[model samples]
Structures are given as structure tokens and as C-alpha cells.
Target: MIKNVEIRQALPADAPAIEALYPAAFPDEDLVPLVRDLQELAAISFVGLANNGLVAHAAFTPCSLAGRGDNVALLGPVAVAPDRQRQGIGSALLRAGLRHLQNAGTGWVFVLGDPGYYGCLGFKPDDDVRPPYRLPEEWRGAWQSLSLSEHKTPLRDQLTVPQAWRRQALWTPYGL
Candidate 1:
């Protein structure tokens, strides 16, 4: 059973455990390197621990909108150990991580995740903020945003993300 999970910023020493969590949670994909690259690129990473062991992780990386000067971030690669799924660990990690970014003065955060899940966290599909690449119509709905402090100002410019996320395939669901 999931125990008292603590959420906190990830440290360099947590790399090995964080790396292992990715592949174990997503066996069909090789996302360890991507996550590592994000870490190397200075993404804000957070981990959830229970019994002093890493159980969940979430990463938020920098992104920009053409012609607009507000601070923005991309959220992805959130993972929970297979054994820890559906136990609220992921949600707790996300809430804590988002709070970190918001307090850091981030104006907005974008994510491509399940509407049912992220929607509950105040994320909503926003066609206004265009991604750098074209997404399949079927998956367009997955692009969502959450303005910090519940701001309603819509972003209507092309979004630019980190080099690792430049791959067109990365714009799809679970493409990390």
C-alpha cells in the first residue's frame, strides 16, 4: 500500500532512482534519456518519496511564445511507479510541482495529458496557444494550458520548446 509519500525538489543524487522509474512505468518507451536531457537542460524536477525511496516524479521545462514575453513552462514526463499508480502520488507530485513553478512567478504552464486527469487540476484545451509543430486533428484536443492564479488571458502565438521536444513525435500523447 502507498504510505506517507513526501514531495520535494529532486536533487542530483536522485538521478538513478528517477531514471529507473521512467522505464519501469513506461516499458514500451525509452524515455530515460529524454528525462535525463531535461534534467541536464535545467528543467524543474520534483520527486515523491515513501519510506525514503522515490515513488513518483514530475518535470517542468522552459518554453516560450513567439512575440510574447511572459514566462511559460512545459510539463511532462510525470511518472509513478507501476505499483504506485492510482494512489494519488502522481497528483500530489503535480500539485506540489505546479505550486513551485507558480511561486517562482511563472505566468503559465502547458501540458499534453489526459483531459480527465489534468482537467481536474485546472488545465483546459486551448487552441489559441499554437504548438511549434502541427498535431494530428484527433490529438489536438490534448494540448492544454493552465494560467497561474486562474488568469484568463489567452496566448495566441507559436510556442517554442526545448530542443529535446522539437521532435514532431514528442507533441503526441505519451511521446516523451
Candidate 2:
């Protein structure tokens, strides 16, 4: 279990470490490029700094909502060091990142993640906002959203992720 996890904005110098993190965190998945490209594209990102190093990371990319005035972002590709998994470092880091986004006037944040895990972070199934590509029916519940604003407005629209996230494999509901 990690203590003294300081949450901070991910710096460019942290790229190397962040690149190494995903492969270790998800050995069977090639999530490094997703986050690396996102960072290069200036995605809103954060890191959990600990005595050892950056033990956790989370990145959110801006998304355009069709006909919606609200500012929205898509959260993904969060990673926690293998040893730090389930120690709450990832969750705390995510909470800190979410707070930063909320304070920055982000109206809502969407994530394609496990309902149980993200639900703890205030995300709910938002059938109104559809993903860029249609997700499998079995994975529909995996698409969720969390409102950062006080106003309970339904973010009803189609989500268009930034070019950095246009990879079809990233949107696939299977083999991952």
C-alpha cells in the first residue's frame, strides 16, 4: 500500500515514466500509445507521485458534443502500478483529477469502464450521449458519465473524441 501519494499535473518530463507505466500495469494490453499520444496532444493529465515514483496516472481528452453547449471530456486509460493496484492510489488520483477538471469548468466527464469501479467515482450510465462508434449491446453499460457541474443537465449528444483517440481498436468492445 502506498502512502504519501501526491497528486499533480503530469509534466512532459514524466512521459518516459508514464510510457513505462502502462505496459507494466496492463501487460496484455497496448495502452501505452493511447496515453502517450494523448499526452503529446496535451490531454488533461495527472499523476500520483509517491516516494518510489509516479505510481498512478489518468488522462482525459476533450470531446465535442453535438449541439450541446456543455464542455465535456472523455476519461480513459488510467493506470496504477501493478504493485499499487487496489491500494486506492488510482482512485484517489482520479478524484483529484476529476476535481481539477470540475474546477476548470468541465461540465461533464465520460468513461468507458467498469460500472462498479467508476460508479464509486460518481459515474452513471448515460444512454443519452453515445460514443463515437457503436458499442456492443453487452458493453452498453460500460459507457458511463459523471457530471462535474452543479446543474443536473443531461449531456445528450454524440461524443466525438479527439483525433488522438480515433483508433478503432480503442473503441472496440471485444478483444480487450
Candidate 3:
């Protein structure tokens, strides 16, 4: 557990700390572009700080379902300081960010993460709904969603990937 952790919206000043945590948490890939995308698309960014230094971060990006459209959000890039793993910092950051987005009028939120973790947070897969982006088979069951709106609506028959993200091969069928 961190000695003095605080959860709050991420600021421009937190970029460096956020950047540093990414490589430490994900050394297999360069995440600069993903980070930029999150900053550009998120309705809000959140961070956890300890001793005035960032220890965890998460982002909630604006998203929408095409055709049977509804305002939605995407959660991503949640990271915690390696030393602080399993300390509940990631959960705190996610809960705070989700609450903020819901209060700000986001109708739903989606995430591509471990279902076991997100399930505890009220996320579930819309097996009845399909997304345009072909997620990996293993991920299909993990592509969970949560609705914040009091009156739930049927999920769109199909989901649509943002045009910018559609080009990624990871979203293609074989790759998926």
C-alpha cells in the first residue's frame, strides 16, 4: 500500500509520471500514441498519487455505438506503479474515474480487460450485441460493458470502432 495516495483527475503536469509508469508496466510496446489517443479522446483522465508522485493512472475516453447510437465511454491504459501492484490503487483509480464519467452524463462504459477484475465493478459482456471491431476470440468474453443510465436501452445490434482505431490490424478478424 502507498503511504499517502490521493486519487484525482490527471493534469498536464502528470504526463511525465504517467508516461514513466507506462513503460514500467508495459515494456513490450511503445505506448506514446495510445497515451496521446487517450488524452485526446477521454472525457476525463484520472491518476493516483503518493508522496506527491503519481502511482496509478486511468482514462475514460468518449465513445459511441454506430447506427443505434448512444453516448458511451471507454476505459483504458489503467496502470499502477510496479511496487504498488495488488494494493487496490488501480481499483480506486477506476472507481473514481467511472463515477466521474457517469456523473458527467456518459451513458455507458466499455473496457477490454480481465473480466474477473472488471466484473467486480459491475461490467458484463453484451453477448447479444456485436461490435464492428472484431476483438480477439479470447477477448470476446472479456469485452465487458456497464451502463450508467438509469433507464437501460438495448445495446446496438453492432458496435463500431472509431475510424482512427479501425485501421489497426488488431481489430481485424484474423488478428482478432
The C-alpha lDDT values of all candidates are 0.86, 0.86, 0.74
Q: Please write out the lDDT profile of model 1 over residues 65-102, one tens digit for every residue.
A: 98356699989888999998999899888999888899
Query: How many pairs of residues in model 1 come into backbone collision?
Result: 0
Question: Residue-wise lDDT of candidate 2 within 1-176, one digit each (tens)?
Answer: 24688889899999999999988987888987788789888999999888859888999888879745558999988989989889898888889889999999998899988888899998998899999888889889899999999997876779977787788788864332
RMSD in Å for all candidates: 2.2, 2.0, 3.2
Candidate 2, residue 81: Cα displacement in angstroms equals 0.3
Model 1 Cα shift for residue 164 (angstroms):
1.9
Candidate 3 lDDT over residue span 56-115, tens digit each: 988776766764456787777678888988888998888888888888888888876678
Give TM per candidate.
0.93, 0.93, 0.85
Residue 132, candidate 3: how far off, in angstroms? 4.2
User: In what order do the candidates fall by TM-score, top score first?
Assistant: 2, 1, 3
Off by over 4 Å in 3: 1-3, 67-69, 161-164, 167-176
Which regions of candidate 1 fall more than 4 Å away from where they truly are? 1-3
